[model samples]
Target: MSGADQATRERLAEEIRSLRARRERLVDELVQSSGPGDSGDASQELQGGDEVAAIDERIAELEKLRAGRIDVQGVDPGTEVVLRFSDGSTQTFKVVAIPEEVLAGEEDITVTSDSPLGLALAHGQQGETVRYPTPDGAVEVEVLSIRRPS
Candidate 1:
């Protein structure tokens, strides 16, 4: 990896850490706000429940990211990759620790490190073939290329 690429990866990792911390703090605050024995209005309690649920979902995603943290010298998170299937088909996807909600409606596809294919592709090099087992059987994919976003 180039100096710039390494720097970018470090920045992204730091961002993930920062976001996780923020979410943790938010969850704590929500828990405190919705504590039992508090004589709060029913509507307020209902709203708090909704907020808690949303925060819980976000926390779950962050935990997945924390568990999938990678320190490999190659194929780090945030790298765009092209995979060639056995039948001569190719697909492009961005390897991300967590999916970016801003790109939710975009055409770009992202794969998290926790996923089966993502786990197999992590730290892989160009021209390397990775096989992952599925319900039907095993699937083999070739890493055609890995590129850093511009």
Candidate 2:
């Protein structure tokens, strides 16, 4: 596994832990509602219980992935690249070994390590040009820079 891949796995595992906490809280609530002598609306509680169980199952799957993680490594600490998509749109991003900063009211875009673009960017060097095959012909882009996630 690559260093970058290892870091990404660790980061993802942390995120899974956070989500698991939420799922566990919901499970506790469901267990309490399912206890005997409860005269409340059991149907709604049962629905919620099902949802919580599903989420817990999902978290468990994530945990399994974390345990058997494989990743790309040895990425330089100063890699940055500009991605030009097929829609004539472009964005610059850094291949960091950590999660991006949280923004207020802004959605986070987590680029998967398995994605073509992300993988290409991961192997790219500064000033290198990479061409990606898209549904509409091909998209060409240049690597402006590279950097660590820090």
Candidate 3:
């Protein structure tokens, strides 16, 4: 893996940890705020508190998923691989986490370490290839090299 790619992955892992911590803090606050409500306005405030708690819960879930990384075992961080589609065309892609900028979209293409294609590639050695079936058909991908992102 390139020095830069390693840095990026480490940065993302740190970000996930930070987000989890923030979510935990928010949950604690929400729980403390919703105790022994007196009624009327208090009930309304409790409802609001609960809503905030729900949001925090969702954030926590996302953070957990982000933190629970897949084992790229044999695959190194910087791997130059190809995805050969059923059309007999191949595209080069380096497997990595979904960039923060691309998180809202392009998620499938970004391919997480846990994703089907990503997982298949994970632990794969150089010169090894795997095939995955898509709606279009089956595509075979070959692993050329593995290294941390550059």
Candidate lDDT values, in order:
0.65, 0.57, 0.57
> Would you estimate the TM-scores of all the predictions?
0.48, 0.44, 0.45
List, residue by residue over 1-150, the lDDT tens digit for candidate 3. Answer: 123344454655676677567657766766676767567747766665676676567556545435544334433444556665446666666555434323344454455454567667766666777865668776677666545455
Model 1: lDDT of residue 94: 79
Tell me the TM-score of model 3. Answer: 0.45
For candidate 1, the per-residue lDDT at 120 reads 82
lDDT of each residue in 50-112, candidate 2, tens digit only: 787787777776665556544444353334456554465667654433232212232223343
Better of 1 and 3 by lDDT: 1
Model 2 CA deviation exceeding 4 Å by range? 1-20, 35-46, 61-68, 71-79, 82-92, 96-112, 120-139, 144-150
C-alpha RMSD (angstroms) for model 3: 6.6
Question: What global local distance difference test value does model 2 have?
Answer: 0.57
**lDDT-based ranking, best first?**
1, 2, 3
Candidates' RMSD to native: 7.7, 6.5, 6.6
Candidate 1: list runs displaced more than 4 Å. 1-75, 100-102, 106-108, 148-150
For lDDT, candidate 1 versus 2, the one ahead is 1
Least accurate stretch of 10 residues (summed lDDT) in model 3? 97-106
- Point to the candidate with the largest TM-score: 1
